[model samples]
Target: MALPVACLFASVPVYAGEEDIYFSDLPMVASVSRLPQRLADAPTAVTVLDRAAIRASGARDLNDVFRLVPGFQTYPNNTDAARVTYHGLSDEDFSPRVQVLVDGRSLHSPLFRNGMNWALVPVALEDIERIEVVRGTNSASYGTNAFLGVINIITVDPSVVRGFSVSANHGNQGVRDYTLRQGGKLGEAGNFRFTYQQRDDDGLKDQFDWKDKFTSRLFDLRADFSLSERDVLEFSAGHVEAVTMRGRLAKSQNVLIGGNNPGWPIHDFSQSSTYLQAGLRHTLSVNSDIYVRYAYVSDWASDRYLNQSANPAYNYDEAGDQGVRHEFEIQHNFVPLDKMRLAWGGSWRNDAVRSDTVFRGMSWVSRDVFRLFGNLEIKPINWFTGNLGLSTEQDSLAGAHTSPRVSANFHITPENTLRIGYSRAYRTGSTVDYRANWWEGSSLNFRGNRDLQAEQMDTWELGYLGDWRGWRMSLDTRLFREKIPNRMIQVQNQVEYMVEVQKIQINGLEYQWKWQPFDTTRIQVSQSFIRIDSEFLDSALAGPLSGLSAVPRTNLDQLGERSAPRYSNSILLMQSLPFGFEFSIAGYWLDKMKWTRNSWQDRYSRGDVRLAYPFRWGPRGGELSYTVQSFEGNHGEFKSYGQPADRVVGRRHWLGLRLDF
Candidate 1:
């Protein structure tokens, strides 16, 4: 691995273009600490995915795009929800350790176990301006759910997108997608944009149960108004409806009858989500500003299904869940002194959930959360920088907690810097993790325990950033160690519920490098190596399972240690071809890993390529492109517990056409 990386950076021609993108020495990030700072001066390491890289990767969804980030892992899902994690300890069907935001609005909600739903995200790829991903814990700034990392998505300004655009995609596996967008001047001092889109595709093939498929339709609108010279107003609204097929058949009638639970029958699971957001910002002076924001989100899913058993008395009904959230916040950023900057904010949120299937007979369960946070940065000298951050949060479900962080950056030279940082973060259990009461037959399938405590994580990291303008190359690297004393996990069998049953220590090294070799050629590469250690607690040894001795401790330890792969790598290249043509290729390789304790997935390597051509006719212009994903043949990335087969991914080909009018 080291030899290949060294050879790539050994020698390159001296070529620069006016449009070449370089790693700047100035503070250039806005999402890490709620303040804009140069990458070298920031408190933590961050990866920026701009529009050009996003387009060049040829990713149709947000989950696939994260593959470019070091230490990040994501897998495709058919009927089930997709999952994404960093330095992972992942759940079977949900990713609850990371926080995600879009335009300052949190996507973490009770709807999907306090995690973002990749399939239900309302915004289209074309509307995204850039994505900034903080590579470590940031609870000191964002509060809970920022346990492992943070992802902030910034959208393009409406003023720059004035016109009508339409696009269509057709491909194998019943893939059909369409999108229409319009942007214009709303009034004398306002701009607005509207979009409608629909995506449809046949899900995984050769499934054990039912033939799976996915469909979704969405509508989004945004408007920005200049109320005054110092005050600006922004409002946005979006809605999405998704339908997916789920469930599996029984292997045999005797096996189903003996277990007292029948096989899952084929069913349609439908979900609908909507959100409204507004914000007002006032510039008090050249170096000071204040913003007030409010948001409301609602999500509902209907997963009704019937279980069939050999005995008629064992039949049962399942699935109907709904949730809503309301939040308000105010923030202020100012230059306090000659060499110091400060930012402070406060927020209040309310979340409510109602489910007959998940919560049994519960009508509605609600929780209120309040948070206060502040960050201060000081640059006492030209070569030294220090940062301090703290956050206090009060939650009705998990009580109150405080998080703090400290960091220092030393500029070794104009083009190189080194950083050291330490921080502690906390993660409260989600609604389902703390309030669920699922029942099946005469047993408690899953029950929430009020005595469960919030999980805590302590992290220490050393980072470096170097840029070589002459070679048009840059590299960013980090070495980190994370310790979680009371790590949480969900137990199986009777009385199944979430509990803190182990201690976890993770050590990892990851880096990303970029180079623009020529005016028309660009390259980006990233790699990660991780090692995890775990120790089981007494609680795990004395679990609530009926047959406690049947489970082995080695299996329990593997659950935490093997959640993340030992090594992973990605490479991408984009080149401009002759005659207005563009060519790009990307490849990914990951080590063998498991999504759950009882599931197993083998190591796999995959490649994707895209080719596009642009043309013009009179006043109209358009682009036609062809994309092939997973070109390396069939492979599996995830497996379900107790299932004999893994989720196999096969090759797919799609063609896309876009027109601007």
Candidate 2:
């Protein structure tokens, strides 16, 4: 079936054109500019994810969402353990290096290793307007969390919608879900929208009787009032709340050693968050306009490890993050000269983070941090564009640092554009690396690196883009080499029952491609190759450092060999059939990679399908749909040193109904 579909796509005749369609016409997942000027002129690799494609693919979470994106990868640690990786290097969590935004507000958590709690992101497949993905470095434009890439999610506007809609679904693995949405206009300038959704299911795997569940509610209100013929005020605010319960796996050996207790120690996690944003825009002249934006985000999470016998004691972990940012932008469309137009802008932001932990009537740890930053952009010609930006920030604990960026774009022809860009990106070291006082179980203390310097990277890229009628394509390849004078790593020795830690720097490259061969089908592919040279390591910790932790112990040579096969790719197909019917299929594949001082090899491939048909009853409409995910029942697995590999267990299926009036 897939072969015939591929043949059909290959047989289609290529369309041709001279006028380049604006980037605004591309479906986006995030709030990018509604015009093509920024996308065409910006000196970065950006890809847009359309809503039609998203609906067709039937992705239920961030993992599935990123499968269609190139150069991005994800690994499931267990039933409850999932993490994203980019540019070949990844932390326990990838949030700090890859910034994610919903409607222009950053979703990164300043308290939790700079990673966003994916379980709390208030995004529903049905509400997505578009997603804008920028690959390579972007710390200069979006601040701290943009080390490797940026994912921006945009939701539908209230003004363009009318009436109410509802949907219900059920599927494999005991899956059940539902969604409710309402949107319409009020009076002359007010528009409002509200959406509610819930999901619950016994996952595909049988390990620990895994159960996945979540609930989300969102509200958006917008008001447009004209103060004068030349000025107008636009006010908007959005609020979202989400909650979920996640399950984790316990090593069988650990369970057996402790006794034949199945309920030994169960790991369960939960998260909740609320986000609010508002913006105003005014036209100063026919050629110029100015706008301001503000946002407030609050998030909380709790993790529990419960002992199942006698009087079960629960070790509780809790944390919260609050952020506020303000931005001012100005645009002028008038040409400075014939064939040349100029646009420029500036932005400022401030972030605050706090966290705490507790176990058996004791305060484990606590910390707080604050950061301030600013940036700018400029365009000199219609066919040629340039940008120069810099930011200086200070952390209460990590001190201060400065970053700079520069980029240029030149139109080779109306049908082809060339781009060259460079940026310096950095990430503040985590508290665990700075202030952990004790090991997981031992009384031995680990001191914090107060003098630790931020990890920084120098990234450069060359890209080309072309568009012709229904055929659109883009290719961007980047080379990144980073230097971390105080890089951090945690090492543990099982043979000698000892532990050692240190830091080192590295370098790498990323390649990406986006091709849409038909109006109903699109294909994206991304690959990354990285090399790390650890110039420092304690030679005395031989066996554990060189044998057990040989992967990291190798320093430069070890880093090089360990960094191969760090790549990911995916393909998606969606078709709108005649008579209100639709069908979609998507496939994703990722290479095995490792994390921590432990040598772990991991990899997996999966596919999903969705079908829907609409029916009408008088003036109302309704639809029935069916979805099957992980149709191949692929299981994720990880191998650790001296220990048997652990498999990530789960699969899912769903059926649903929707109504509109």
Candidate 3:
């Protein structure tokens, strides 16, 4: 395995300032090795979304966060219904292709088709330490659900924070938000931190008006007790409470049609998550170390309809879901021979999910996964290095899969490097696809497919990186082909008022870029193109079925194309100003993409800007900022079956303030 990138950048103390050490530095992890290497020394593409850049972009949520990073696309009808996709295999109502994690905890709901509940994640932008985005397939290193990419959100360590802060913002569409955070040390051996945030917005469209809110309280306690100079033990726990209202579906059939319909009844939902991790590290020798870690996760959520029609015959409903996961990981590093390094690790995870619908009953599922992987690093020349790795995972639903990866870095000159890499990745089938119960003529019937298979991808990347004086720029592009066999979709047998479950396969390509012209300026851009085709397998099917079908296709399916986007890209720019101030601007463009098999295309372009100033008052510190989001005021449209396919929604703007002591 390649040594942590920290070892290489440790000697390069290009910035010598107190704030540089705390606010602008990347975490010391091995994942960033390819970033700092010269453009001529490596052949793989990489993008780094630094903390300062993220803060300057004025992104309000994770959807806005991706606006600054190229190659990733976030689709949010409103604050509550948001989903991200990579390489163009996405649906309006499903989990994304990429995997999202915050401080090593997955943000996906195992019972809801493995999709994310965007509204429940209460991470304040101010508390983010940094975000590491790995584009291209990385299942070999991170495991399943990493078929497209990995987004790792690293938070601020309590020990490094010594004060408190608070912030509030109000904007268009009745948007309002407030956040508070505090951190300090207890004696010399213990450290703790806590944060809470709430957000509510009326949204851009009439029917789309909704509320997105979450309150997350986290506690991290760390104590160092040394039995000897070479041993240490650490423990930590994090908890979060996120609540949101699901927006009204564009499809009328799914909406309440009778009296007292407040346009759309709020779908009250909540997600509570808790995580515990414990680790022990030991140094066997001056150049070797071994560690063991055990982690546990508990997640629960409930979605319920509020304020039903007054008619006694009408029925209101609620659905509750709960899941628990336990993981064990072990890793070791050693120099068994001269000038050669080796690192290896293995992990095991088990997840159990249970769900119940008020009108239906209850269902349960259990899944277990185990993985083992190792990497070796060797230097063939003083400036040439190579890394090779292999991993295998056994999933309860998808059987077993093995992936092999290889990468090389070559230092051609002092200022440039070249990187090349290739890997295979796969995504396990979602539980939502295997087990679900949609309403059937006012009655409920369970729908499931036990034969669902894992989606797989083969990825290859090439890239260059460079650094000189105060200017640094890097570009990474990838060519990939993914085979999503047994891909799930909902098929309706209208003749019998019954729905049949089915699957299909798809294939595509993704490309992205990152650049920095000066220490205070940065820009990023990316695009994805895909081609999807499907075939039906149910014996009840008749003639020929051609193109891909959007999940839960409504009347919209009759108007457009299926499951593919022609192209999508985002551009972002940020620059620091005088007086602890910063300025930022971002623009997003989505090409005309088909909503259903024959629905008309909807295209849109949006932009946002912000101005921020950081200062201190008495013994406290604070930040006053004003943001104008959706400055372009573009009117967008959402298409759905059985609903007017061309309804328009307007844009919005907002401003906010923050304080810390």
lDDT of each: 0.82, 0.55, 0.58
Against the true structure, whose lDDT is highest? 1
Q: Which stretches of candidate 2 lie over 4 Å from their true place?
A: 1-38, 76-81, 208-264, 305-383, 431-447, 470-486, 490-565, 578-580, 596-601, 614-619, 637-651
Q: What is the lDDT of candidate 1?
A: 0.82
Stronger candidate by TM-score (2 vs 3): 3
TM-score versus the correct structure, for each prediction? 0.93, 0.78, 0.81
What is the per-residue lDDT of model 2 for residues 56-140, given as tens digits with 9 covering 90 to 100?
6787665567766656665542333355545545534534567888766777754455576565557667767667787766665
lDDT of 3 by residue, 470-587 (tens): 3444444555444543443444343111122233333444555455666777666666655555544453244112232444333323211244455667777777887778888877
Top-TM-score candidate index: 1
Give the lDDT of residue 49 in candidate 3: 57
Q: Candidate 1, residues 289-322: lDDT per residue as tens digits?
A: 8889999999888877655553443333333578
Q: Compute the lDDT of residue 30 as modeled in candidate 3.
A: 38
lDDT score of residue 561 within candidate 2: 36
Candidate 3, poorest ten consecutive residues by summed lDDT: 494-503
Worst 10 residues of 1 by lDDT: 1-10
